[model samples]
Structure formats: C-alpha cells, structure tokens
Target: MDTPSSSPYGTYVIAVRGFVAPFEIGVYAHEHGRRQRLRIDLRLTVRRTAPRFTDDVATVLSYEGLVAALETLSEGPHIQLLESLADRIGDLCLSDPRVVEAEVSIEKPHVFPQIDAAGVTIAYRR
Candidate 1:
C-alpha cells in the first residue's frame, strides 16, 4: 500500500479522503462559468520533526490549515482540467517540509450519466 509505515521516507501519515467541494472547472461549453462538486482524495506521508510526538500542533501538519487552503483553492480562479486541480493539490501538500510524498485525486462525479465520475490522480515526492 506504500503507506508511511512501509515507506522509508516517512514515519506517519495525514490524509483527506472523500472531500467534496463546489469548484469551477472543466473544458466544455456547458461547464464554463459553472460550479460543480468535486470529490477530492489526498494522502500525505510525513516525517516527525520531534524526537517524540507531543500535544503541540507544531509537531505535525495542521489539518485545519490544509483544509482551509483546499477550500480557498476551490473558490479561487477557474481551472480548466482535473489534472491541473490534482497537481495544484500536490503542490499544496508538498509545501509542508514534513511531507515526504503526496498523492492527490480529483473527481467530477455528476458530469456524465453512464459513469460515476471523471478524474485525475497525481503524485509528488520531495
């Protein structure tokens, strides 16, 4: 599964899964200037900066900060593709020095009738 416990680069993991938010993205004419729900899944392998984990928030990545950044990004300038969205997410995750690797996936679930969703997955390592 390539988890933090299995990977030599990190000691723990922080993840956001099944996060859905309204986003302005897509290439088709019908999608222009429109908002749609995007399902986001992210995983980050992080290393401990302290000798022992403590109650201090500084000891680990701030979950609130990550979620706030993501929500702000969703409300920011329009993006054209799911790949771009996923890549941006990867960049956000990799910004934290503790994060050794990041995997981001974005899906547009209601775009088509036949399929559940259309999306892209991206991975980045530091």
Candidate 2:
C-alpha cells in the first residue's frame, strides 16, 4: 500500500515541541479534580506542490494554525487517556488537505518524581 512517507510529492515538515499546558487528563482517581502540566510535541508532514518563493502566508502551511487547532482541542471536554488525546491531535493535523502524516506525543511531566515524564506517542497518515 502507498504510504504518506512514500508519496511522490515533495514533503514539508512542520514541528512544535515543548509545548506545555495545563490539562485535565488521566483515569486514576487522584488524577481527577485538577489540571496537570502536560507537554505536547507534534511533527507534521505535508505534501506540497513544490518549493517557491512567496511572501504570502496563505500559500504555505502555518504553524499558527496548528497551535490554534491544539488550543481548540484543549478547550474541549476533559480527556481521560493519552492515546485519545494523541488521536485527537492526529485528526486535527490531518484535517488539512495538504497534511499527509502526523506524529504526536503527550507527556505528563509531574506524574512521578523518579522519572522525567510518562506519556504516549502516536502516528497517523492519510
């Protein structure tokens, strides 16, 4: 089967890393009633016609748009699972016709003291 990574069109990568935010997420009882610090990292692969010099922002994918989409998702109802959150992010990234694939990672920085962080990573392709 043809894959997004193997597409014939030139691929442009957009990434956002170390995006920390307060989120209400988790399945355990202690995880309820408050928001925790969550770090989100995303990398998107978009299929573009070709590279050309253009001053217009509309012609190319905007990182602001990706952040806006994430903000919108974060404003929605509480999410219980990291997998679900990753899926939602992937869906948002894929919503753009130009986007061919997305890789998302969600981390809870304060979950444990011994370890750095615990989280989930997922990938989706159109």
Candidate 3:
C-alpha cells in the first residue's frame, strides 16, 4: 500500500491569470494622465510544508491573499515601467517562505492595435 511517509515531498501551484487592473503608469505622453488596463498573470511554485492533504485553507497558499495584495499594489502611486511592476509582484509572491519560484507577466493590450499586447515577463527563484 502507498503511504504518506513513503513519499514525503509535495508541491502545489497558486495562480492568478488574466487579472486585469487599471494602472496609471507609462513613459509616453499619451499614457500620461489616464489609467490603462493592465493584465497581470502570476504563478507561484510552492513546496508543501506537510505531506498530508489537510484540506484546510490555512495550510495552503491562498490566491485570495495574493489577489488582495495585488489589488493593493495596483492602488499605489503611478509606476514608470512594466518591469518595475513585475518586480514588485515577484517580491510579493516570494515573501512566503514556501514559495520556490515566482513567474510574473504584465501586458498592455491597448498600447497598439497592430499587436495583441506588449509588456514584460519576469521570473524569481530562491
């Protein structure tokens, strides 16, 4: 029979995809005073502290908490670069001790009509 003790390592992922937020950020004059919609995609790779499936919210990384944190970040002062925004998100995800890695991507869809989107992707590992 398979037992929890036989294989102790476990991992899980918490992700927020296509989370759109209006951000007042850009270096261009046209992007100056108004808020532009930014789509945020985040993935967190987490190592389980315990082997068993406790089925409890407290024992797992809560996407709700992450979303709340992201909301807070979006409400902050105007940002100058998409890279900066991605770094801030990486910091927030990696704050949890169990998080092994964080991958963040932010896209500006309306910046141009020729392409789908334009932005940056950043990854943080520990």
Best by TM-score: 3
Could you tell me the TM-score of candidate 3? Answer: 0.90
lDDT: worst 10-residue window of model 2: 1-10
How would you encode candidate 3's per-residue C-alpha lDDT over 1-126 as one tens digit per residue?
643223246677888998998998999888778888899999988887786769999888899998899889888888889999998899999998888889999999968879989999999987
Q: What is the lDDT of residue 124 in candidate 3?
A: 93
lDDT of 1 by residue, 4-114 (tens): 334443367788888888999988888889889999988888886556778988777877787888899989888888988888888889888778888898889967799
Task: Tell me which residue pairs clash in candidate 3.
Answer: none
- The residue ranges of model 3 lying beyond 4 angstroms of the native Cα positions read 1-8
The runs of at least 3 residues in candidate 1 whose Cα sits more than 4 Å from the true structure, single-residue gaps closed, are 1-10
| Sort order, TM-score high to low | 3, 2, 1
TM-scores of the models, in the order given:
0.88, 0.89, 0.90
Pairs clashing within candidate 2: none
> Total clashes, candidate 2?
0
What TM-score does candidate 2 reach? 0.89
RMSD of each: 3.9, 2.1, 4.8
At residue 68, what lDDT does model 2 achieve?
79
| lDDT score of residue 19 within candidate 3 | 91
The number of the candidate with the highest lDDT is 3
